[model samples]
Target: MIPSDDRQPPQKGLFELYLEDMINLRHPLVRMAERIDWPQCEQQFGPYWCPDNGRPGHPIRLHVGLQMFKHMQGLSDRELLDQWVENPYWQYFCGESTFQHEPPMDESTMGRFRRRIGEEGARALLRMTVELGEGTGTVAPGSFRVAVADTTVMHKAIAHPSEARLMARAHRRLVARAKAEGVTFRQTYERSLDGLLMRIGRYAHARQFRRMHKRLRKLHGYLGRVCGDVIRQKPYGQRSQALDDSLYQALYLLRQYADPKHRPKLYSLHEPEVACIAKGKARTPYEFGSKVSVITTAKEGFVLDCQALRGNPYDGHTLHEGLMRVHRHCGHLPVHTLVDRGYRGSEITPLSNVRITGKQKGKGTAHPEHQHRRNSVEPIIGHLKHEGLLDRCHLRGHDGDRIHAVLCAVGFNLRKILRRLARLFGLRFIQELLGLLRESGTQTGQSMNQVVSIPV
Candidate 1:
């Protein structure tokens, strides 16, 4: 018979054995995570209880949440779930006892969980990251310094909508969804949008076009009656009220623009505030969402604040909120914040703390270092759009846009943390292993008896 040891499967790898062990001893983020009151931070999410006498799922929630947060930054839920099955590191992070066949929650469940957390929860997550950074001894408390500011457009996830098309689509979608959800109505239009689309798409003959427009007008009027009936009939309950509020808002905008007024109101049920913002870049002539300003530290490039401003306000106007977020994140106001020419204005110049870079009125000594540092944030904006998840907004409403931006910032910080952890781990591993090698006479030429200590 084979011995027990001989019969056993191969020993689990050091990597598979423990994730904490894989983490570098001196990695700042790791050290910071350990020091923070994660229990307190995690309390914001859960006190999940079991059904029978209800055992708490707090540990599971926290672990799973942190894993989700990582995934929200680095990968999709489907991709993360796949990794959890195969990668020990990911499984360990997610608190899996065994390689699970299914994810702890489905993708839709993940979305609901995010909604439950809402914008406030996302902000809390950001605060936790900032706090962790501060506790790490890497960033000094008061010295969380200059945050460079810039804006990028996050596109809404709907087809580019024209005024007429948007109104028609918005009206149809609201009615369809409302009806499907069992909301009562006196009348609902059975007409398809094909005719409306055709009429709008073809504009050759004035006489025929007016005939088509009259038909479209009748359809719009019919939709309005259906919406009004639904509004009157539906009970004033939580869910229905919320739906009604949104539907009515869309309907209001559509009707406001149906007949040409001084200004045509833009409306899209899918993404109501999807604006046509032009930033004047040669590559991207126009972007289809609100302009969001992101501010980050110059020292380590950690994002301090992000805001989704509607109507693409001038950069100078958003300064107060940006600076306020920096203060909130760092627990101290930033000194000598840097910005480009767009942010230069009398309103901004009054704040002695903010240092604006642009063409000087007269030739004077230029601080090349400040100008260089001012431009540093531009790459950060690109990274957020290209690599991080801020290129497009998957959610709807202004709140959704804000959440997307915050999640991107959080994702970026996590990536930063992972890179720092990997680098530190590698350096320490090489040093300690090299010393061990010297001691073991692994290096044949080295004196075996000599004591070997790794240099810091």
Candidate 2:
């Protein structure tokens, strides 16, 4: 059931009574907590829950705060929980009234929360961060009029694909599934598979192409035999839907591996949705994952929007949709967009006032500032990949790719806001300290110059 605000309060124990006395109320997290719109978040997220069924869910702030903390720190769910328990500042950020010895929720709870909120909810979190940036003055009111756009590959957490590895993984999955479903196979290749894979790797590394081809063919043959056995045992009519899907994927992998002309190929066995994208990098020639478009304000580094594009389309083709997403999320289209030369020849519908960088060429440009701002997004993308969670996405499927990208942007913006607030508070404290010193100097019948010379 949806928990009511009037739920009975727990009796305060001795430890709870003394908790506030031990914690620092002036911490950045505590100040940020006061600044955040918790009620708005609760209202936005509260609809995902049923009002009359299911057990009472955890507070919305706890779940939301956990997500922000997760991507902000680039931590997994387990690590977030461990750190949350030890840090009182984190607890206060989550709206906890008093410290607790136990974790707020289990590691799996984060997955459930993500699935429940889905992509739209993730975008809401991004919007909240954007709003916070504006309210905190980190991003100026007019900055939203100008946005920078760029695309980067958010690599999937999977091994680099190879012919041998693909065939071996397919064989192992088919064997494991057949055993689980009680469908007997003549030869599972259980003992020989590992050694065969090892030999294939060694052959490839040693530049022995002939031996590598032989092992790959052997592995492929083993997979096909096992697949046939499962089909014969389970048959078309009696097989479970999951078993049928597995067999289909195994067959698809076998076909793609055997042929060199398949247009779209599966790269990872577990994550079939992963795509191999080539971004023309010398060191890293190819990246295996989805392409993400990152939009940020031209002057300030706050992220405006993040969207995952499928099929690895040209960077130019994604501009129209990227602008629409910016409009949808930010409530207005940027009056001008600064992008790198990759976006040249893009079929962006011309807006009379909207200025796009690199579109016009001449000695004197319409907006030369936009061209200079284009390179700013490069470092923003780097920070999103390294400091934010956009380096490697661990969530499943295309939906996971989109949601993870948005959340990473959210984390980036929140971290910036927190730092700005910390600086603001630090300066205020210094100003107050100077005022106190001046007042003390006056009371001691000494000039401010005399007080300035006093040392510890």
Candidate 3:
């Protein structure tokens, strides 16, 4: 059974102090927690859980609160949990009634929670952030009428894809698996493989192509011998799932390098969904990651959606689908969609007025004065990378990419909401201070120049 978040508060003991009394309730995080509908959040995640004989799971708010904190603070799973223990404001945001000494959940439980939510539930989380923005007037519904969209590369957490690195990685993996599966190869190449791989790297760096090629051939021969030994044992049908998948990658890498004429050399053995995206920059010619389409309102810059495009589809081909994602996530679509020159020939669209910002210059689009508004999304994307976790994805496969993109959006909107609340709180505080000062001087019958201290 899912843990009910709407339970009654515990009765305060004679000597116990409440967390609400200890902390400043005017804090933005405290106000944010109060405004969030916890029951609705529990309902969104209730279907994903099953009513078992096991004890009730942790409250959905706790897990989701940690998730938002993870991205908002740019902390890893372990880092977030460690800090969660020290921060009482964070505890209050997660629905804690009293200050806790230990973390509510572990790092592994957080990972399991993400898996349970999946991509659809991740989108639901994004929708909830959007709804939070709307309810607080942080994002206006009318602003969603005109939106800007752009694509960016969200890099994967992998080393540079080089032949030497891949070959060494494969050889080590094969040797480890062979040892684990009780199938030993003839020569494990443990004696001199390190020197050879090192020499190969130095040769390439020193502009010694001939030496690099010679050392690479030895590495290739060593890999081939080990691969042949493992394949002969026929571990495919009987080995563990991980080993089987590693063997497939080894085979793919072997075939990929057997010929020197392979064009697309940028490939990751571990992450199959990663693609090379070329944005035509002189400093960095190609980026190895996934292409993500970002949609935000032209006026408010509130992100409507962030769609991770697989297979590195062309920008023009992704417009219609991006709009659909915006509609699905935000419960509405833009009457006017603005895009850049990359989507020039994108004629087929769900919206009747798909405005190419460059082509429209001042032509037949629905919103002409908002031509410069398309550039608003660029800063938002930049913020997502810098302030949020969209810079480099640390999660695993295709599903990880989708979930991470949506969470980054959630973090972005969360910050905006918090900032708005903080500003409004600041103004209210100043107004109250002025009122107190005026009342103090009037009651004391003193001149306005004389000062009076107000007890805060």
- Which 10 consecutive residues of model 3 have the lowest summed lDDT? 447-456
Across residues 85-134, which tens digit of lDDT does each residue of candidate 1 receive? 66544444444333445555566656655666677777777777687666
| TM-score against native, each model | 0.73, 0.91, 0.91
| Order by TM-score, highest first | 2, 3, 1
lDDT of each: 0.64, 0.84, 0.83
Candidate 2 regions with alpha-carbon error over 4 angstroms: 4-19, 179-182, 350-361, 446-456
Q: How many backbone clashes does candidate 2 have?
A: 2
For candidate 1, give the lDDT of residue 331: 69
Order of candidates by lDDT, top first? 2, 3, 1
Clash pairs, model 3 backbone: none
lDDT of 1 at 192: 56
Q: Higher TM-score: candidate 1 or 2? A: 2
